[model samples]
Target: MPTVTWSRLNEDRRAAVVAAAEAEFAAHGFSQGSLNVIARRAGVAKGSLFQYFADKRDLYAHITDVGSQRVRCYMEDQIRVLDPTRPFFAFLTDLLDVWVAYFAEHPRERSLHAAASFEVDTDTRVSVRAVIHRHYLEVLRPLVRDARGRGDLRPDADTDALLSLLLMILPHLALAPYVRGMDPVLGLDELSPDQPALVVRRYVAVLAAAFAPQPLTTATPGGAQSHG
Candidate 1:
């Protein structure tokens, strides 16, 4: 949360602080981000940052909130392109492609977001994770409803379950660079962006299989139900 002092700063000064902080957090993550460097980059005295933010934790929360707002804007743009008439797998694949591509097109933004997944302080993580999760569900509902109505998904499909799975996979879209840095031997980090896209395409197949309706059968009059 930004303090009243932070909100009262002139827009230029405000942007300077925000930009400097974003760069630091993007480059080094929260635990490693340097207040001293942030203040110097903003051309403010180190103590001035405390005036706008209670501490590093507050600053991280503000940054995470701003990131979520950016994600909201991106998803708003994406909602227009969603089409229930498209094949469900194709639509889903394209949608995820656009999501991963958004961050791909902006490396700094991607890094800032990926920062959230790292060693986070527990106090901030709970609230921050909840806010982003709420946004994910908000953006998912209408498109899912439309898909169901258009017969792209089964009527019994659990939107919650599906969304949970999708959101879990969505973070992995940004994990390539992080994974590469953490341990190159794991091999997932070595893939080109297109390779992950193909892997996720296979995941879409699994999701489609999971959501597809099962055939209903009845016991034959003469005998027993066959397990095979």
Candidate 2:
């Protein structure tokens, strides 16, 4: 939490501090992030940063909250518009498209997020895990239940496991090429407009085959007709 002094600062000053902190933390994660650099960037003396935030940890929490809130807003918009009636693959694929769009639009935040994943403090890591877990429980779990009610999933499918698998793989797939130099999921790190999406769809198709229930077949009084 920011101190009263931080709250009392004019909007421009507050923005400067946060923007500078965000850039520094994004570049080097918490351990390596430099408060001196942030102060320099924000045009404030080193002593002044303490008036706003108690320490680096406090400032980091604020920056992370800002980032998570923005991401949550994007997710809220997407989840509201998703149709449960669509096949799981179709729906998940669309959701991935939205995710890719989110990253693309907020490219400045990419290193911020990657730093959180690879080199953050224990507290930050725990909080991020909680946030992601909550997002899936609140937004994604319902989608799986809706699909089950509509018979899109197997009668005995473990909704928890299915959602977990998705939560694990989707983000990795999105970051594969960048995170792993020789990733099995290729083209994601390439700067092409379409390559990332193509990678998502291609892998999603393979995973969906395992998760999708049998295709529905319509039946007349005399016999069954496949629904193409």
Candidate 3:
């Protein structure tokens, strides 16, 4: 085994505590989760947790920050190498694939996000929304603009609207498996591993078809100068 430094071990312990707190909150929600239980599960003393985080709310915020960074890093690593000249749908397909893979591997992180959504404070909601929006828009708006400039999307298409649509769709798709258990109408459990990609492809295809620039067509023969 590789030797670890004391600082590295401390960082690992802090991460463990955060992960344990996330799991506890995900299982019981913020109001009911116990810090002592989290510390025990993380194999760190309760005082160590307090040393790292001032309170439950502070720890929860840190967990959310970590989760946000995890998702941002995942998307950045995948999208960084994408060919800018490809059709916008190609990039979207890659995005959907990355999202599916990430959610599959980090179901607990997804659960933590879902649990955090139920917190009662308006300020907390606003802060979380700002963080999410900043991360998404920083990466997504430029891609949307590039697609429009390349004639893959209509020039009139609103980047913010498209981004919002994608944001709405991805989480719904990611959580569909669990949602289907509560309401069979969702039918997400019916999807195989490949189905997420297929579904995203179809959705993007339809959107692109609707929004792609239309070339002007001239009237043929004796027709009165009609245009498409």
- Could you say which candidate leads in lDDT? 1
Candidate 3 lDDT, 1-228, residue by residue in tens = 112331356677767877787789888766567888998999988877656655555566666777778888877888877665688887788777777777778878678666655556665555555656667688788888888888888878766778888777766656664444532443456866666677777778777766777667888788866567
After TM-score superposition, what is the CA distance of residue 188 in candidate 3 from its true location, in Å?
2.1
Backbone clashes in model 1, listed as residue pairs: none
Q: Please identify model 2 stretches exceeding 4 Å from their true place.
A: 3-5, 45-55, 81-85, 120-124, 127-129, 132-137, 177-182, 185-194, 215-228
RMSD after Cα superposition, model 2: 4.2
Candidate 1 wrong stretches, greater than 4 Å: 82-87, 181-187, 214-228
Alpha-carbon error at 192 in model 3, in Å?
3.9
Ranking by lDDT: 1, 2, 3
Worst 10 residues of 1 by lDDT: 177-186
> What would the TM-scores of all predictions be?
0.79, 0.74, 0.76
Give me candidate 3's TM-score against the actual structure.
0.76
Predicted candidate 2 versus true structure: per-residue lDDT over 1-228, tens digit per residue = 789999899999888988998899888886678989999999999999888878766777677777767777877788679765687778888888877777666765566667666665787666555555565577677788888888777787777878788777655643554554635536555546777778778868866666667676787776968674
Tens-place lDDT per residue, model 1, 91-157, is: 8888887776777777777787677777467765664566667677777777677777777777789
Candidate 1 vs candidate 3: which has greater lDDT? Answer: 1
